[model samples]
Target chain A: MLTVLVDGVASGMLLFVLACGLSVTLGLMNFVNLAHGAFGMAGGYLCVVLLNQHGVPFIPAVAAAALFAAALGFVLERTLYRQLYGRDHLDQVLFSIGLVFVMSAVVDWLMGARQQLITLPAWLQGRWDFGFMTVGVYRAFLIAVCGAIVLALHLGLVRTRFGARLRAAVDDAVVARGLGIPVTRIFGVTFALGSGLAGLGGALGVEVLGLDPTFPLKFMVYFLIVVAVGGANTIVGPFLAALLLGVVDVAGKYYVPQVGAFVIYTAMVVLLLVKPHGLLARGAAR
Target chain B: MSAALRFALQALFWGGWAGAYFALPEYLPLLAQIAIIALFVLSLDLLVGYAGFVTLGHAAFFGLGAYAAGILAQQGWGEPISGLLFGAAVAALVGLLTAPLVLRGGDLTGLMVTLGIAMMLFEAANRMAWLTGGADGLQGVEMWEIFGVWRFDLFGRTAFVYSLTVLFLLYLLARLIVSSPFGLALRGIKGNRRRMEALGTPVRARLVAVYTLSAAYAGIAGALLAQTTQFVSLDVLDFHRSADALLMLVLGGMGSLYGAMLGAIVFMVAHHALSELTPQFWQFWIGIALIALAIAGRGGMLGLAGRLLARWGGR
Candidate 1:
């Protein structure tokens, strides 16, 4: 049981790392970016390519993956996403879904529709045993790294000037703009940051989650669930939600193999019905 | 635009189908598929365009209808018309049950809830392989002749006739409903919920009624496909089904029934042609079209035509 809990926590940390950017973007910008997983897919594939083909080491490959996705996010935001900032949610959905399809097809073309393999370093391999329980070394590393990211992100959002500006913009974009805050620039930077985090998570998660052409479509729901259940904009909200989801998912699969993902999807529908604004949202219901 | 001219145009529009039945006998299967898709898109228009509920899990109803009909047929009750009605009823019942959950949330919440419900249904269907045949799909679905005559042929002549007739009847019904007091109230609710409620309209009731009706229409479409093909697959419940239906509705013009049909024809025809040419990359082109359409405008083909006509008239 303790081992399961640890595994769940590890998976949850990974999910938070993967989905926190999506939560922030959805909450702050009120944008429905369904294509966020495509960015993760991009990062996952980049990490795979860097490690397998280029013989690059794992850590630097993961960093490069984050940078590459961040740069892609930055460019896409300025050119394409900018045009869609104020569009209706339906439009945003259609546009983002379109991006997902395009990206999926592109990946399929480049990668031959096969799952990519990631080779971890020797130290990251094998399992560690304690007196009470045993845990995978890689999963422990994931928890440590992702917990650090969450802490850094929390501090970045709370302590930094940029974080304060972001919080204000999330509160009210119009008022923030009136106060001469570079709301647009903040959005761009945040979008890039979010995409970068997704990339980093994707690179890390490829080992556990598997990397393939359909990665975006397959995992889109989990990311959305994290964002929605976490309450849109807050960092910690998604963190908690992701942990709950990870635990529930791992436990569900382990306990009731026959039911599959029905439990999670049903829980999400029930949760959304009960708390549409999510558990942590502070504003009036939209 | 006069009543007589409208009548004439309508006759000509359907007349074109009859003409194609004789003229393009080889393409009857494709035509039948297009007709079914058009009906599906029309149902989506009722929800997205008329009622202003943007959903991404409409396939839940479609799949429910298909499975219900397919299982009934596979179980030895292969009567065609009743099977269609049964499928529609099952879908409508499910839609009615889920309507409150869908209406409880805002747009994003609605999207997620509906999607979640659909995914749950998909998972349930996948798990219940004994009944649903799992991923292999429900097989041996033998649809009987329509009204004791005119057996379904491999050439799809019967399928085309059955699908087109269903489409026409439903299209007419949809037109009647949209012009009714209930439909007007739905439009009002879509425009402003508070105002509609203040105007003494039971906004929730109207929405529920229309949503149920839309589900029934989608059910009918799914039933027609199942009956014609004599099979049902899990693809009937897939996300792509909902996404494609939404795309077709947008392509034709939201809230416009005729535009819905036209869009279905165009999209399916393009799909048929494109897939044959570049099967692997077909989705890429569709993605490009969707992005361009979203970026360009929401008016779709009919909107563009209307704009061009206005420009010419102004000139």
Candidate 2:
């Protein structure tokens, strides 16, 4: 039971990393960015390339992957997403779907469509034997790192000038503009931060999920399910949803092998039926 | 005399173009395939264009039709007409059953529901190996000769002519439906559902009808595919198939039947050419095309054509 709890928390942390970015972007921009998973895939592939091919160390490889993904996000926002900022939801969806195909194809072309294995370095490879339970060092490290990032993000959002400006802009862009805040730059910066977090998640998740060309397309639905079931704009909502989903998924797979893969979607449907505005009514409030 | 002569000349040119493709033995099968794809895209256009319903599960109907036809053939129902009828009937039944649940929600709700339904069908197809032949799919579907005259040979000579005729007939039917009062009601629903409902348009029932009609079209297309290919695979119900159909409809421009055809032609041509050139990177090229079109060409190929014609007329 303790092992399951630990495993569930680790999985939940990974989900939170993906869901938080989706929630932030969806909350502020009201743009359903389906292409977010592509960044994750790209980051994972980049980390694998850096570590396996270029002989880079682990930490630097992850950092480099995050930076690269952020840069791509920056370019994408400037070139394609800028035009779609205030467009209809259908156009945004189609454009992002197109981007998914393009990004996945590029990665598949370069990486040859095979799943790449990512192994942790020696320092992170061992297991810690607790008196009650033995835990993977890597998994424990991932949980710790993700938790720290979440704490840092919470602090940054609640207790910083940038966070204040972001809140103001998200509340009303026109009002922020009236107050002489650089709303456009803030939007770009926020998008980059969200995308960077997704990259980090992808890089770390490689050890757990492996790297494949179709990974983004397959895993994206689950992330969106989380974002949709949780309140899109609320930070704590995703955290709650992620933990709930992670536990359900792990427990379902262990307990009911046949229907395990479908538990998340079923849960999402039930949640939506009961509360169409999500658990916290983000869509309704918006 | 001069006006009559010009009309005759133009008629001759277009008639020759259409006739050459239809009559040629080798080109018949290709033409037929194009027609089937055009019908598939047209079905999508009705939802995306006329009804403003963005669905990613349209392939469920198509795949169901294919499996229906395949199962019937396996059970010794090899007659072509009955096979097509059976496929359409099964698809329409499924679509009608699912329409109420699908149409009650908002845009995002509808999308997720359809997606979930499609995934369920896909998983069921994989799991029920006895019924759907599992992942291997149902093969060896032998089609009977049309009216006891033309055998569907391996060369596809008969299949091509039959599919072309079916496509032309369906095109006319779709055009008529889109121009009818019911079609106007759909347009009204698309523009403003609340107002239409207040005006007593029975918006939900109308949407369900249109959804069923579109499913029937998809079913026919799928039956034709199974008949022509002599096999049915689980890939028919895949998400990518639905995505491709959506892409074709959008690329062609919504609410335009000819646009769907034009979009399919352009997309298929590009896919064939790009895949031949760089098979691994073809999706990237297609994606680039889609993004470029979305950014630059709002109305798609038809829109571009209209603009060019206007420019030339002005000159």
Give the clashing residue pairs of candidate 1, or none. none
DockQ per candidate:
0.79, 0.53
lDDT of 2 by residue, B37-155 (tens): 87788888887788878887889888988889988887787898889889999989999988977776466766766776777677777767788887898877888888877889866
lDDT of 1 by residue, A203-273 (tens): 99999888897888788899999999899666888899999999998888888989989999988888888
Candidate 2: lDDT of B219?
Answer: 91
Q: What are the per-residue Cα lDDT tens digits for candidate 2 across A1-286? A: 7777787788888888866777767656788687888888888889999999999999999998888888888888988898988876667767777898998888888888888987689999988888999888888998999999888887888899998898889889999999999999999988887788888888998987667888877877677777777776556777778878877877777777766466666676666656655677645454
TM-score quality measure for candidate 2: 0.91
The models' CA-based lDDT, in order, is 0.89, 0.80
Worst 10 residues of 1 chain B by lDDT: B271-280
RMSD of 1: 1.4
